[model samples]
Target: MTPAAVNDADIHNKLRKELAQSRVLLVDRHPEARNFLRMTLSAVGITSVRNAGTAHEALRQARNARFDVILADYLLDHGRDGQQLFEELRQQQLIPLASVFMIVTGERAYRRVVSVAELAPDDYLIKPFTADQLQSRLLRAMYKKKHFAEIYGHLEDDAFVDALAALESLLARSSEFALDGLRLKGEILNALGRYDEASEVYREVLAARVAPWARMGLALALRGRGELAEALVEAQALTEDFPEYLAAYDLTADLHERTGDLTAAQETLLAASGRSPDNATRQRQVGHLAVRNKDLAVAEKAFGKALDRLRGSSLRQLDDYTNLARVRIDKGDIAGARSVAADLRREFRGGKGSEAAESADVAELAALVVDSLAAGRTGDAEAAKNALNAALARHDSLANRRSTAVSQHLAVDLAHACLAQGEEARAQALLRRAAAEHHDDEGMIDRIRGVFARAGKEHLGEAMLTQVSDEIVDLNNKGVLAARSGDLDAAISMLSQAAERVANVQFLVNAAKAIFTKMNRDGWDEALAERAQGYVRRAQAKDAASPRVVSARELCQRVAKKYGVQLESAAKWKKGTDSEAE
Candidate 1:
C-alpha cells in the first residue's frame, strides 16, 4: 500500500477506538430518525446514549448530563430549529467546552445558515448518510477537540502566553494539526494585543489558500493597527465574498461606525439579524445601532425580538427588559414602557437585597421618571425623584461592600432621573461623581452630555467636564516637564498620584511611560515592572480601542522584552455604554 493510504488506515482505526467508549445524545423529533441514530451509534459500541424528541427536552437532557457527542436534527416542533437550540446552548454556556455538537439536516438549504453563525456546531451531516459517513464526521470533530483541549483550557483561564506555548508545542510535534494550531495561534496573538504577529500568521495562512477566516483575521489585525480605511476595504470585500458570514457583517458594521457612518452600521446589523433571528446578542446589537442612528422604531422592534429569543433561556439579562422599556419610552409608547418596567421589577422582586435587584430598582425608577416627564405629570415626576433618592441613599450606604463599578452605574441612572425631574443641582452632583469615578470612559461622558443637552443643561455639563479635563491636563503637563528635566522619579510620582485620585486613561498611560522609561534606563525592577504593567492594564481597560492606549501598551511590551521579563496582557473589559439602555 502507498504511505498515504497506510496513514489513512491508521487514522480510521484510531477513530473507531475512540468512538467505542463515547457518550452520545440524539435529538430528533422523528422517532424513525432517533432509531437510526441509536442503531448506528450502538453499532460503533457507543452504548451510553440518550434521546430527546423536542428542542426543550434536548436542552434539558444536554444540561443534565455531560455528553461527549450530540447529534441534533435541524427541524424541531413549534417553529424551532436545531440551529436555534445550538445558539441558545452556546449563549447560555450550558454545554461543556469539550462536547462535540453535530447538526443533522434533511434540507440542503440548512448549510447557508450554519455557515454564517458565530457559534456553529462542531460538524454537520446531511440526511441519507450511512453509518460510515456519520462515524467519519463525528470522529473528526471529537479528535480535533481532544487534541486541542489543553490550549482551549489555557484560553478559558485567560493565559494567552501559555495557550500560545501549548499551540506552538503541538505544531512542532505534528504537522497533522498545523492548520488548527496556526488558527488558534492567530486568535491568541490578537487577544494578547500583538496584532502585528497576528497579521503575519494570517498572511501566511492566506498565502497558502484563499481562506475566509484568515481574511477576516487580517481585517481585525488591520483595525488593531489603526488602519481603518484598509480594514474597511478588507471587511467590505469579505462581506461581499461571504454574504452569509455573520461575523463579517459585524466587522463591517464596526468599521462603518468607526468611520462615522452610523447609518451603514445600523443597516448591516439589521440585515444580519433578519437572516439569523434567534441570535439575541446580534438583536441587541441591532437595537443599539438603531438607537444610535435615531431610529426608535427599529430599536423597539429589535429589542422586542431580542426579548423573545431570551425567553425560557438562561441567557436573559436585566438590560434586555430595561432596553425594551427605554426604547418604548423613546418611541412615545409610555404604556409599553410601563408594562416592560413592571415585568422587570416583578422578575427581580424576590431578590430585593441583591445587587442585580437594586440595579433593576434604579432602572425601573428611571423609566418611570422618564414616563412621567413625557406625560407632563409634574407631581408624578417629583414622586419618582424622591423614590430615586431613597434608592440611591440605600445603595450608597452599602457602597463600602460593593464595587465602585456598581456605584458608577447607579450614579448615571440617578443623574438621568435627576435631569428628568428638573433637579439640576442633584443631576450636576451625580454627574460630577460619575466623572470622578469613570472619567476615562468617553462613551459614558458623551452619554451624560447627551442627557444634559436634552434637558437644556449642556452648558453646565460641559463646564464641569472642562474643569475636570483642565485639572488633569495641568497635572500631565507638570509630569511631562519633570520627565524632560531629568527627574524621572518626580514624573512617575506625579502621574501615579493623579491616577490614584481619578482613574483616567491619559494619566495611566503617562504613568506607564515614565515607569517603563525608568526601567529601561536603570536595571529592571520586578516591583516597578508590576506597577507599570498595572498602569498599562488600567489604561487598556478604560480605552483599549484608542490608538494612544494601544501604542503605550506596545511600548511597555517592547521594554519587557528588552529586560527579558514577561508582561501579561490585560483581560478584555466590558464597559457600560449609553446603548446599555438598548
Candidate 2:
C-alpha cells in the first residue's frame, strides 16, 4: 500500500478502538429508529448507548451524563427539530464543544439542515444509509473533534489568548481543518473586541470561497467595530443569497433596530419567523418588535406561538405568558387576557418548597397585572386600582431577583398600569428605572417609549429617556475622568457607587476595572479585591459576554496573578449555569 493509504488505515484503526469505548445518545421520535441505531452501534462494538424520544429527553440525558457522541433525528417531536436542540444545547453549554453532534435527516431536508450558519452540526446522515456509512462519518467527525480538542479546551475556560495561541499552532501546520481553525480564530477575536483582526480573518476566508459563515462573521466584526452601515449591507446580501440562513436575518433585524428603524426590524423578524415558526426566541423578538410598532395582531400571534412552543419545556419563561397577555390587553380582548392570566396561574401553581413559593409569588405578580388590565377594560375602575396597587407594592422586591429582560418587562407592565390609572408620577419613576437599568438596550428603551405613547405622553417619555441617558453618562464619566487624572481612589468610589445604584453592565464593569487598577497600583487589599469581584459578578450577571466584562475579567486575572491570590473560576460568574463558557 502507498504511504497515504497506510496512514489512513492506521487512523481508522485507532478510531475504531476509541469508538468501542465511546458513549452515545440517540434521539429520535420513533422507537424503531432508536432501536435500529442502537443495533448498528452494537454491531460496531459500541455498547454504551442511551435513547431519547424527544428533544426534552435528549437535553435531560445530555445534562445528566457526558456523552462522546449525540445522534439526533432532524424531525424531533413537539415542533423542535434537531438543529434547534443542538443550538439550545450549545447556548446552554450542556454539551461540550469537543463532543460530536450529528443530524440524521431525510434527503428532502438535507439542504435546509446543512444550511445552518450560527451553529452547524459536526456531520449529517441522510436516511437509508448503511451501517458502514454511519461508521465512516462518525470516525471522520471524531477525527476532526480530536484535531480541535486543545482549542476547545481554551474556549471552555474563556481563555481567548490561549485559544488564539492554539489556533495559531493549528493553522501553522496547514492541516485539513485549516478553514475551521480560521473560523474559530475570527470568533475568538470578535469575542475579545479585536474587531479589526476578526474582520481581516473573515475577509481572508471570503477571498478563498463564498462561505456563508465567513460572510456572517465579517458582518459581525463590522458591527462590533461600529461600522453599522457596512454590516447591514453585508448581512442583507447574505440573506438574499441564502434566505434560509436564519441568523443572518437576526443580524439584519438587529442592525435595523440599532439604526432606529423599528418598522424594518419588525418586518425582518416577521419574515424570519415565517420561515421558522417554531423558534421561540425569534418569535419572542418578533412579538416585542411588533408591540413597539403598534402591530397588535402580529404581536398577539407571535407571542401566542412563543408561549405554545415553550409550554412544558425547561426553556419556558414567565415573560412568554406575560407578553401574550399584554398583547391581548392592548387589543382590548379582556376575556383573552384573563384566559392567559388563568393559564399562567395554572402553569406555575402547586409546588412544595421555598423555590416553588417564590415562583408562585412571581406568577401571581404577573397575573395581577394581567387581571388589572382586564379589569380596567371592563370598566371596573375600583378593581383595577386595587390590583395595580398590590402589584406596585411588590414590583421592586420581585424585579430585583429576575433576569434583566424579565425585570424590564415587569417594569414596563407596571408602568403601563400606572399610566392607565392616571398615576403619572409613578409611571415616570418606573420608566426612568427601566431606562437606567437597560440604558444600552434599544429594545427595552423602545418598549418604555411605547408605553408612554400609549398613554399620550410620548414627548415626556423622550425627555425622561434623555435625562436618564445623560445621568448615566455623567456618572460613568466622573469615575472615568477621575481615573484618567490618576485619582484611583475617587474613581473607585464613584464607579462603585454608580454600579450599586444603577446596576448597569457598564457601571458594574467600570467599577470592577477601577478597583482592579487601584489594587494593581498599590498593595492588594483583600476587602477591595472582594468588592471588585462582586462588581465583576454583577457585571457578568448583566452581560457575561460583553467586551467590557471580558476586559474587566482579564484585568482581574492579571491583578490576582500579580498578588499571587488564587481566584475562583470565571465560569462561576455566568448567569445561570456553572458550566464552561460558550
Candidate 3:
C-alpha cells in the first residue's frame, strides 16, 4: 500500500497542516488505503486527517467537517461510487471555496466515470501510481492553494489589495516553480494586472511547448500592451492548433473589439459560445455584446441561457444574473426584470454565514445597484449608495476590492444618472473620472464610449479607450499634483477635463476622488458640487461605504432630491435609458 519513494511522513504532515489550517476530508473503503494515506500524510509532517470507509460515513464526515481537500476512491464499497459521494458533499457546501479536491481512481474506472465537467476534480491520481506523483500533486496543490486562497478570500472579503498582493507574491516567487508552478504563476500574475511579467512567463513556457493557456495568456498581454493585431494573429494561430480551446476565441474576440471591429468580435464570440454553450461565462459575454449592439433577441437568448447554465462559481453566477436582468429589461419585462433583480440580489448577498459574510457584502451592494437600475427607481440609488458604503466600511479604510469596485461603479453610475437627468457635461466629467480610476474594466470603457459618441465627443472616448494602460498611472500622478497645489479648482477642473477627455472610468474616479477630497477641505462650489455628486452617486451604487462616497452620501442625496431626479442602478436599465447612457 505504500507509495514507492515518497516519504510517508511528508504526506502525513501535508494532510494535517492543510486540515488544521483550512479543511481536508479523506475517504477510502480499504482499511489499508486509509492507513497508508494517514500514515503517509503523518510522515510528511501533517498532524490531522479525517477518514471514512463507507459512502454514508464519507457523506457524514463531509457534512460535519469544513475541509479544504477531499480524497475519495473511484469505487466506494457501499454501492455508491466515490464520485457520487463527493458530488453530494459539494452540493451541500461542506468544502470552502479554497478547498483542494482530488480523486483517486484505478485506471480501469476512467471510462466508466461519467463526463460531468461541472464535477471535474481539481487534481486526480491514478491508483498504483508512485508516491512521488501523489506527493508532487499535493505539494503543488497546497502551494497554489495557499497562493490563490487569498484571491478567493479577498474576492469573498472584497479586499482587492490583499488579493492583488497575494498574486504579486505568487508572481515573484514563481521563478522557483518547475514547469507546473510557472504556468499557474503566470496566470496569477496576469490576474494581478502585471501583464508584462505574465507575457514573459508565457514566452518562456511557449519556448518549450505551446500550451493553450500560455498562448492565451500571451495574447492577453500583447492585447493589453496595445499590440492587438498581432495578438489576434497569435490567437488565431493557436486556435487552429487547438480547435477546441475556447479561451482562444475569447482572446481573438477581445482583439477585434479593441480594434473597433464589433462585427468580427460578435461573430468570434458567437462561434465560441455556440461550441461551448454550457459555459455560462461565454454565453454571458455573447449576451453582453449582443445587448450592447442592440440585438435584443440575441442578447435575451444568450443571457437567458447563461442564467440557466449558471452552475459555476459564485461570482460568475452573479454576473450572469446581472446581465440576465439587463436583457429582461430590453425585452420590456419590467416585472420580470425586477423579479430577476430580486433573485440576483439574494444570490449576490450569498449567505450570512461567517465564511460568506465579506462576499455577501459585495453581492448585496452590487444587487442594490442592479435592482435599482432595473426598477427605474432612482430612489434606490440612495440605498445602493448606503449598501456600498456599508460594505466598504467592513474592510480597511483604503485600497481594497470593495473600495475599487465601489469607486468605479459610483463614478460610472452617477455619470449615467446625470446624463439621464439632462446633465451631459456633468455626466461626461464623472465618466472621465471613472475611466482614470478603473482602467482594467474593458466593459465599462466600452459603455462610456457610447456616452461620448452620443454627446458628439467620439474622438475623445476613442483616444482615452485606446490608451488606457498608459493613462492610468499618469492620471493618478497628475491628479495628485494638481490637488497638492493651491489650485483646488484648477486641480478639479484639470482632472475632470482629463477624465472627460477619455473613456477610462478608473481614471475619472481617481480624479473625482482627489477633487472631492480637496474640495471638502476647501469649500464646495455649485458646479464642482454637481460634478462631485455624480461621482459620489457612482461610488454609492457600487458600495455605499466607499471612503469618499460614505462621506458625501448625505450631500448627494440632498442635491439629487432637490433636482427631482434619482440615479438609476447599474444593473437595471430600459432601452431608452440605455440609448442615452452612451
lDDT, candidate 2, 1-582, per-residue tens: 999999989988998999889999999999999999999888888899999998778877777788899999988885667877887777665787888899999988877646653357888799988888899999999999888989887666555677789889888986788888888899888888999999999999989987898999999999998999999999999888888777889999999999989899999988887777888888889998888788999999999998998786555788899999988888989889999999989988987887767777888888998888789888999999999998876676676866323466877897898898998998898788789989989889878888888889899999999999999999999999999999999999999999888888899889999988988999789999999998887777677667787778777876887888877645533324433221
lDDT of 3: 0.59
Question: Could you tell me which residue pairs clash in candidate 2?
Answer: none
Candidates' C-alpha lDDT:
0.72, 0.84, 0.59
Candidate achieving the largest TM-score? 2
Better candidate by TM-score, 2 or 3? 2
- Over 4 Å off, model 2: 1-17, 112-119, 396-406, 519-534, 556-582
Which digits, one per residue and each the tens of the lDDT, describe model 1 over residues 24-58? 88888899989988998877778889999977677
CA deviation > 4 Å runs, candidate 3: 1-22, 25-122, 126-177, 184-201, 275-280, 307-442, 445-582
Better of 2 and 3 by lDDT: 2
Candidate 3 Cα deviation (angstroms), residue 544: 20
Where does model 1 exceed 4 Å of error?
1-40, 47-67, 70-99, 110-121, 146-150, 153-157, 169-173, 311-313, 351-381, 397-411, 432-443, 466-582
| Weakest 10 consecutive residues of candidate 3 by summed lDDT | 573-582
When sorted by lDDT, best at the front, the candidate numbers are 2, 1, 3
